[model samples]
Target: MVKGKATLALELPLPEEGTANTKQERAYQAIREAILNGLLQAEDRLPSTRALAQRWGVARGTLESVYERLQLEGYILRQVGSGSRVSAVMPDSYLKAVIDFGVTSTPIGEVPTSNPTESVRSETVHRAQVGMPFVARLANPQLMSPAEWAAHLQRAMARMTPDQMCNAEPQGALALRQQIARYLRNHRGIACQAEHLLITNGIRHAIDLVARVVLQPGDHVVVEDPGYPAVHRIFAEAGASLVYAPIDEQGLDLSSVPEAVHCRLAYVTPAHQSPLGVIMSATRRLELLDWAQRQGGWIIEDDYDSEFNYHRAPLPALKAIDSVQRVVYCGSFNQALFSNLRLGYLMAPPQLHNQILALWHTVGRSVGVSEQLGLAAYMHGPAFLRHLRRARQEYLTLRDIVLDTLQKHAAGRYRISGEHAGFHLILWLTADQDQDLLIEAAAEVGIRLQPLRGYCQQNQLEPAFVLGFAALTRAQAKTASLKLAYLLQA
Candidate 1:
């Protein structure tokens, strides 16, 4: 057997006076330079915390802190039993190459190009293409079993009649509408019949139908400040003037709504406030319903992702408490099941049923009969509940992993909110930190984040970012959290 070469201790130079402000900074710079200059190869083991502390004449705690910073920055990897090793891929390699063309090191899995400009452009594009964490409505596709869905589709197809194939209902298939009514009654606590529901392509389509039917040119519409941009666009395109309402800890602040403003429609994500994630308080919910009833206005309750409530039993939907029939309850299977399916439904008020159906007939194409039938069949069977249970458990695990890692690694660096429900949560940063810079830094290391300001209109909310946890795996949650914590604390 060949003898293995004995590993040698890393010999880093001590900090000189006036060179670095502190020993920690100096030591950090030195080790970072070693890795960047190829003096320390990837996967090379480093001395233990105690050994390094004694070797460098620093406290063990200081050495541990240094290692943690290095690990957080992706320059090193630390395992409890296996000790610390240089990361297989270095972030500095990419940063250095982007800053100056002096470094020729390529990131792992990237192809090297001879043209410097092309390489930089390609790298910039690649960074832009990184998976962003705050993307809303994203779910782990792996959690959904495609084979089972396909089987349901096959069954629906086999049972399809010629009349059903040739003729499609404008209000969607009866079976699907009936199933959706039952689901809403049971899960959302909304008592409504199949006639109250209209099968829509998604929330956007549902909003569009409501807009065309209800909104007049120059009609005043009340929307949440940090609300869904698509809703704003839809109403705007319909020639409606949008009045912004601020969101508070209790959800959309009804007090902020100008009492003088006679709004025709108020669009809200009451179950899970978009971007901020605070559920509309019970008092606020009643207040909103009263506002609509008194003002003769309508409320579009977009219950986007209420299925994955982790901490407490979910509150009844806003539509559940609408006694005056002023609320239109909208929901989608796309977020819960799959995005590509494009299946959503809305429970319209009885008065607008005919008008909505008429407008839908004019503007919308029926959702595929097979898809509607298959989904109806799926919802009726046991597999759908099993899928929900599995997905909820997986999402809950991911949420915990993210929350725990962030709290442990980056304590006091940030504040968290809207974590009790939904696929994403708000990570409010300190007032002094630049949200954009942190976002840019995160993207450089292939961790994408969205600024909370992007979703707001007029309200000057705190500097924060929305962090989605639904699709992250165990390893991804830890790594991304560490990187994010480093960016915030750095």
Candidate 2:
């Protein structure tokens, strides 16, 4: 493996003069200090053993021994080809014990995950039970045959060598990346090698990494107005100045992108616009590509909810038409497998491979090795395609039940949109009321509807609410839609 530089400069501490400890002991102390002081963060890859050993003037065997000790103690993770990374799940008490005392005999326990995205699953469940919008069961194992999944997992585990289990590549498991690349090429018309892909925690994580690597503070970027709110928050956190581009029936309005502001990046959900559910026109996709090529900017094509199109064949991803390597494709398994899975991948230009790998290492690697291996096995098997097919049909049925019930009960009262694809549809209210009040009233009756205005960062949109159907049963949809219709009319 190549010894790569980290985005964040990490200085290894040198031993003190006349220190009684041996070279190995001093090296261990320095590394431990780096982790405790936050110089080496969770999932940050350490320099190659050869490079570090040579730099510190220590024998390779000595470095190996130190690495082994750290691995055994749960301070770092080591794999054969992937080198070592600071343990992301290291226990907090271990750090406290180490810091308080000169030495800690007891190893730290596993650190709890702090990913906010993972918390969404809990919210999804609570909302789903109340028949709320944007709610989906998180990878309910029941959806797949338990015996089949267990068999696949066992096979995946058996195929793994000890090294493969210990340390996972920052990019992702090679087998999984290969399968993802193949799947994309076959299904989405995106042609790319496995190396061009990097597995992320989710779309947010992928977007954040791309924003950080491709954008500078105050750089102008285009975003879909009344789109996925999370996109706005992610870009803002990266210090990018967002220019809202409105969307119509055809998706992101290219004309709205200000000519004066030189856009460095554009985040778009082309397959099905996040809340609006409009496919971007082919002409628009080409025009966006032309804009990127001209400005030397990048387009992040978020293929959100692309798999569940109920109409004709899904449109080719923007990346499929991107000849200049200006489009970075972001996709996730959350919608496919389960929301709680938190597995997403990015396909980028070859020139960005090294930089993205570095950024991912620094940002914090997610998707554990076991999960990656198991997912790879699942994808490789027949079950993945089968599940998607079944899910599409099931969602379609649920969507119809909700829409049919709403139209029958609330006919001519509100305008409905977003029936072409995805798990939810929008209802534009004829009688405008405070969105919060509507939400509160609905919640009082045990329903949760997401207001469309909440998705907009700057653009003014009509009052509407999104009703998610994928998580609702036929009975739930029928009852909730009738109740919702009556509530709106009342």
Candidate 3:
């Protein structure tokens, strides 16, 4: 009854032989209502439990107990030679919204309206319109103090014992890798120890475990021409081949990276060069560490938001002069202490620390040992440098109230670069304005901005946006920089 070529042709109906339902529960409710109405999608491929028990005429052990209850209820994904499919990630990707509450015993697909409280208030107003400011200008968990982070998670769960509440360390919690290896050897000089750190759940899980332990499918990575589009979809989902490479005024343009494209990896941020905030210059960080030592390549160095430097002093870290460990050094406290404190760290380069801790033990501990012993007791105390000197003097007075309200109302119609450090800045427009109608009139007053050609892939710089004043509030940063300087002077 089953062969190889008919993957899916679902037309399930059954239940009529004197019914209380069972042609294997009406073919497991018509294959879970054809995978919750999308008619079987996410990764698709289904049909061969003996060709769906000869197209539902039944008994191949009742379609193998209806695919062993849709693969034990996560709704399909079997494997062992790659057979049953449908579960690329769908335990419940919404679709069950059928309200009609007139209750005819409320059964046939049981109506339970108020769609999960209007789908959690439309996903909390789309996460408060993408955490506003210049859109995700993060770090404002109402400037810390939830009873000082629940008294440092109540002294890291009152000094958890009994084998630290049943062991966990996948390469984390060696007292938070000895306080992130003594805060990267006294602030980013990066001599490194604590077995060359690992702990991640940020910098996109350390570039998805260094693009699955150093990419291979067509290799060549480079990236950073108006970068960080989720590290170009995590190195094009690890099948690699990206290249881009162009951000100047001294950051990533290492002779436009194409000397016969052998580049195994490069993803830089050289301290402050995402969304165009240039810094990488120490002679383009020794010409990108001599093009990663003449192409033996590998250099992630995200250093995300280099501790909010309002103006000066904060360079060093290209894994602090890597003398050939060819840097992997990423860092994050979820953008310093509050973007749900997801925590982050990477260091690596001890010849790829056991292949990045064996692909971080197959992606298990994305971070948890009680939020890594409450961020190693708030980075071994002084309450994380007194909440990074009161959130760097309130994000350096909201980056001088968004640079004196966009230089007193968008003077000479926009051009400001990286504002000396992080928590967002790069305005740049004036090519006869209209960067998407000034980002849809700063999203009709609620403000979000974003577009620098949506972090480009083929250098088309200028005509910019990326604003973020780190969760604004100096009267919402002078009324969102005078409503984005009256939409860049209309």
The residue-by-residue lDDT of candidate 2 on 1-490, one tens digit each, is: 3334342223575587444247776676677557654566678788766777767788878888777656643457888877788773323433343345322122212222233232121212134332344344223333556677678878899989988977777689999999999888767867778988999988888888888887766677788987776677677767666777889865678787755567788999988888787777544565676666556678999997888888644655778656566788999998787777788999887656678889888767878887788889999978999998888887788778878877788788788888878877778888555666777888888777777776766568888877677776667777888888887776
Across 263-293, the per-residue lDDT of candidate 1 in tens digits comes to 7889999888986888776446656766776
- What are the models' TM-scores? 0.73, 0.71, 0.35
Question: Backbone clashes in each candidate structure, one number apiece?
Answer: 0, 1, 1
**Which consecutive 10 residues in model 1 have the weakest lDDT in total?**
119-128
Indicate the TM-score of model 3. Answer: 0.35
Off by over 4 Å in 2: 1-142, 145-147, 431-437
Candidate 3 residue pairs in backbone clash: 134-468
Please say which candidate is ahead in lDDT: 1 or 3: 1
lDDT by residue (1-490, candidate 3, tens digit) is 2333224444546556543235765676577556544566667778777766776677888778777665643457778777787762322212222122111221111112222111111111112122466675778777888898888888998998878778876678899889889877766646788877878888888888888887766676777887777667767766766777788776787677657667777888877888788876544565565566556777888888888886543555777656556678888897788887788878877678778888788757757788789888888989987897798888888888888887887789987887877787787877787787776777788886777776775787767777777776778877878888878887
Question: Would you list the rank order by TM-score, best first?
Answer: 1, 2, 3
In Å, residue 360's CA in model 3 sits off its true spot by: 13
Ranking by lDDT: 1, 2, 3
